[model samples]
Target: MPRMRSSSVIPHLLREQANAVQLYLQYKGYHWNVAGPLFRELHLLFDEHATTVFETIDALAERQRMLGAAAAYTLEDIRLASTIPHERGLPRTTQEMLERLIAAHHVIIEGMHEGFKSAESDQDPGSADLFARFVQAHEKMEWFLRELASEPPPTSEVTGRSSLAREKGVPAAAIPSSHAAPPFAGPPLT
Candidate 1:
């Protein structure tokens, strides 16, 4: 079988590169800003994911270079190429951050699926393999986030009031006030 044309694979590689950079930055933002009850766990998770995403950026860029195309380095170039939606501001809760990260992973996974198909059909095994591996990584990350997002709020052990008491027929006031609100639910940092 004939090898795929460089033109056919380069665009997909470049797009992935841009998405990786954007996702890395978003992860870092959440990592640095996360606070409240689950702050330590969420912060550590975000930073770890950010590092993983950051590692992808170089491989994606090099893949494009191997295809004989110029790797995009300018901020404007990445902004234009990335398909991840722009954020209005920092999320109001850890749940919101988890939701956003899950959605972003979905976008990247979908794009990788398309890119993988294109590369495989074009007989480019290397590019297809890269897409497949990244897809698995993104899927794992998404699953971790989804698990966190799906968890029910903790019940207050002392008073038996759930954090989601208002929705569970218990008086909201009975819930623990200590975990009522996120510590950083304020204006975006300058």
Candidate 2:
């Protein structure tokens, strides 16, 4: 059986797992709905981050089981436990998406920090390490989002292009400079 302190850490871990799930779905939704000059870059970035979050969710739930604890993972449980805000609809712009994600990461990162401290206080090194890793991951993702927010808006070169070009199978970077347009290359945009 796990130590008592380790058991104490399980609920926090479960809450983090729930938040990770929310973050994953939110990232993917933005990946699909994001529009604007930065479409391609943001698209790929969100997808990559979402994949990472999905992995983290799996690992966390498994970790709970490893500790012989019951994992709270149902959608209802996640809805109840997670602090990430509910999204009623897509953000109106790419900037909004970035801001939304940044805000969500802020909450998750804060929670991770608190959870790490709790785990340590509880004398659960394993759980402490897990929370530490999660904090690092969220910090990295937050840095990426914040950096993107600070970047100059996409040049006018990409301003006229439909976000569909990026979504539809054409590489965003390949969409062509004003000097020349390249043929779209990729699987059919479906």
Candidate 3:
């Protein structure tokens, strides 16, 4: 009989499952509570995201069981293991809900990155692949949220000249400057 290798990937998988459960709950909460101009759209989006994350939780838990590790099944276990925070009261606006979703996605991405590192150290290709998929999904979701806040590039009409001038290092004196100081310089002065 082939020797059974002990996999250290279970802990990372369990933690990821816990985080996904927390995220799924938060998404469902926002779906139920979201309001405003985009309520219907946001409600549907949250529900879809929640379902997807919930699916991930199930898969992770099953994988853990397949590896002979016990999966954490209780809410308390999830809460204790999750790095994502459970917001007490959801925000009132659709935009706020979007912002909250973005924050949660960021948290998930961070956790998945850590999970990937752990899985890699354990030589667990399966968990590493799972975490990579998560990173991609979270990044796409973040891009969607960002699109809501995006505006067309400031028109040359507003700047009173083409951006080309600024790009070529034209003197500030030559450019028609707006009263609003260019949003803070690159970094705080040392």
Q: Which stretches of candidate 2 lie over 4 Å from their true place?
A: 4-6, 151-190
Task: Kindly indicate the candidate among 1 and 3 with the higher TM-score.
Answer: 1
Clashes of each: 0, 1, 0
Q: Candidate 1 lDDT, tens digit per residue, 77-184?
A: 999999988777998777778888999999999999988998888777888999999999999999988876663445333233344643443333334666455444
lDDT of 3 by residue, 100-162 (tens): 778878888887888889789877787788889878877887787666533325644434333
Error of 2 at 12 (Å): 1.3
Candidate 3 local accuracy as lDDT? 0.71
Residue pairs in clash, model 1: none
| Selected candidate, larger lDDT, 2 vs 3 | 2
Give me the displacement of residue 161 in model 3, in angstroms. Answer: 22
**Candidate 1 — what's its lDDT?**
0.80
Give the candidate number with the greatest lDDT: 1
Highest-scoring model, TM-score: 1
TM-score of each: 0.79, 0.76, 0.72
Better of 1 and 2 by TM-score: 1
